[model samples]
Target: MNSKKMVLIGLVLTAFFSSLAVFELIPGLLMAFLLLSVGIAVTYYFALSRMRLESLAGISILLKAAKEIGKESKAPEISRQLGLWAQRLVKSEAVLVWWQGEWAFGDEEFTAWPGLETAREWVKNNNEVLVLNQNGGEIFSHPWPSNINSLLGLPLMVAGEAAGILFLLNESKRGYFVPQDSEALEVICQQAAAALNKARDYQEVEYFYKEILFSMLNALDSRFPGFTGHSQRVARVAVLLGSKLGLDEEELRILEYAALLHDAGKVFFLQEGLPGEAGELEEMDKELSVLPMEEHPPLGAQILPDEGVFARICQGILYHHERYDGSGYPEGLSRTDIPLAARIIAVADLYDALTRLAPEEERLEPEFAIKEMKKTMGMLLDPLVVIVLEEVERELDEIT
Candidate 1:
């Protein structure tokens, strides 16, 4: 670039000297002209260099934004990342991500831009790259906060429709938002739109699946008189225990699903040839010599979808019946061999059973249930999980 600039400057100097000779200007005036030409050439070169450098910086920022935003699988996080990236890339004072009707703000120092309804409404209808930079000694004609002298809006388009809009305000330390910033924002929005839309779809689908799971669990629980709200109470207690054990969010989610579906095996208790109905499965199990209660774990695990995320949930359900001392059914997984979720659910299951769902004569208060559970530690329950259950006694009592 410097070499090209030198070549261009040489051509310009050659042209200028030839003009000077043809015009036969006085020496003093000629010297002044030469100085002016040199200064102009130098300023032009520096300006071009700065523009080139800024262009490169914008490209690098866009690449980073696309890579980071594409890596995210959640809509809220995707919008947040895009907002923060835009704020950093363009040095904006504030960024607002309007994701599907939800709004998220990214700020440098938490300055609120008031009275943005007109601008937002206009941008929503226009659905284009709108820029409001009135730096040429002109006041903003739009109804905007005096503090916000400049603004940029980019629509997040998915499948030819707008899924969201991004708004940036007060760029580059209160300076006008340049054209380069707008171009960079357009590229970033193009990259993020599809990802954000897909994340929204996945989120909705996941929520729907959970609703179905809860509905099914409710139906299963309703089949037995004593099992009313049984799965939900177990889930609450399991989550408390899982939290006490320091399980992360994802771990706690799997634990909760497993607890809710722990009794899913009992869904088969209503199958053909079984004798008893409405929570009398134990009597039915003995009378018909049919499939026993211990066999429901595998059946329940089999009923769930085979997705990889649900793998731990299935394992938890499959092994919830297993004992820590190798005395339980099916695989008889012992000690740490039982999945952590299974162990936690095992503790929750017994605790809820003894306190709330058990026969009236067998039922104990929540505190007493914990005390009874203590005796089974390391034999029927994971010792660590049982200890954590004791820690959650205060909360458990309220729920039970």
Candidate 2:
């Protein structure tokens, strides 16, 4: 029976004996028997209740940890946080977690106990919880440390496979951890495994998306002779400038996509009269560049998805060629009316065109290129964006 029921029974017996004793209807020996039984039962019940409360408190902490773990997006970070939570839940002398071939928490300092390798192998092979007591120091693989007498190892199961193990250690208090501790730890490990799996899946998806983006950029570059590296160079320089200006990751991403695909509308302009080969266009075809120059920005915007994250990129492309002095084509947005991303791309696009696309003899040196760009800062480019570009150029010069 549970402690509550046992305590109730003891209380009833005591009341019955006290009533009998008061009326002189019970013997002294019988009264003594009832008194001892009541004392033992009440004491046991209180102790049991305290232990149960402690377990509940531990479980509560674990639940809070699980909620926090779910919000993380990386496997190593999830595992690290899980280890910390596990340590708090158990109040163990040490807590160590191993996941994805790396120690997530409680490294060499906490793992000085013997039989760790044995415990790790057991959990890995059985995919179950393993608890060990230093009974006469017989259960340890090495000479048992005098301070530590018990260890608990729990499997972190993910998708029917063991993802890792959580090891908890206790100081020389024999039988320090009970079966309930193991069960509570199992609950925590299950949540950690789920969080780790989710982080891994998210990372894989991000990697796949990046691969596709790079491939598309390469295919677009192949369409223009002598422009195979132009988009990538622009992307690199634009990102540097964006970083210098303190643009956050999301803003930098938009700027990057806009710069890489700024000239995408050129692909549509490859009609019968345009020289379509990979080399620089012949003098006769130079006039054809003007045909797309007027419409490429809008056409490039139309080439991307119309809504969602790419919308910002589309806006950047559509206004990339617009000038600060209202002399640009299509919409002629002037000054701050132009999007910042487009302005940054405009500077990057001009720099690459001057250095990489100009005829060999006509190409200017890096120092001269900065002077040429300085002439149109307020007229053709955003002055602030030009300043950032100038900083990037200076850094590049120092590096070279």
Task: Find the candidate with the highest TM-score and give its number.
Answer: 1
lDDT of 1 by residue, 1-400 (tens): 5857676876788677767766776475676677677767777877888899998987887899898888776777888889888887777767888767657555533224443544565667777676776542342354555566787878888767666888888844568876667776777788778778767655654774577777767767566676778788888988888888888665777788788888777767655434356765342121111124777889888877666556767888898878889877679789998898888877787777677665577668877877877887777788888888887777776776
Using alpha carbons, what is the TM-score of model 2? Answer: 0.48
lDDT of 1: 0.72
TM-score of each model, paired residue for residue: 0.55, 0.48
C-alpha lDDT of residue 336 in model 2: 87
Q: Model 1 compared with the native: what TM-score?
A: 0.55
Model 2 agreement with the true structure over 35-144: per-residue lDDT tens digits:
99789878977888899998788767878888887666577777788888877777677778877666677768655544787677777888878877766254355655
Whole-model lDDT per candidate: 0.72, 0.73
Model 1: how far is 141 from its true place, Å?
23
Worst 10 residues of 1 by lDDT: 282-291
Model 2 score (lDDT):
0.73
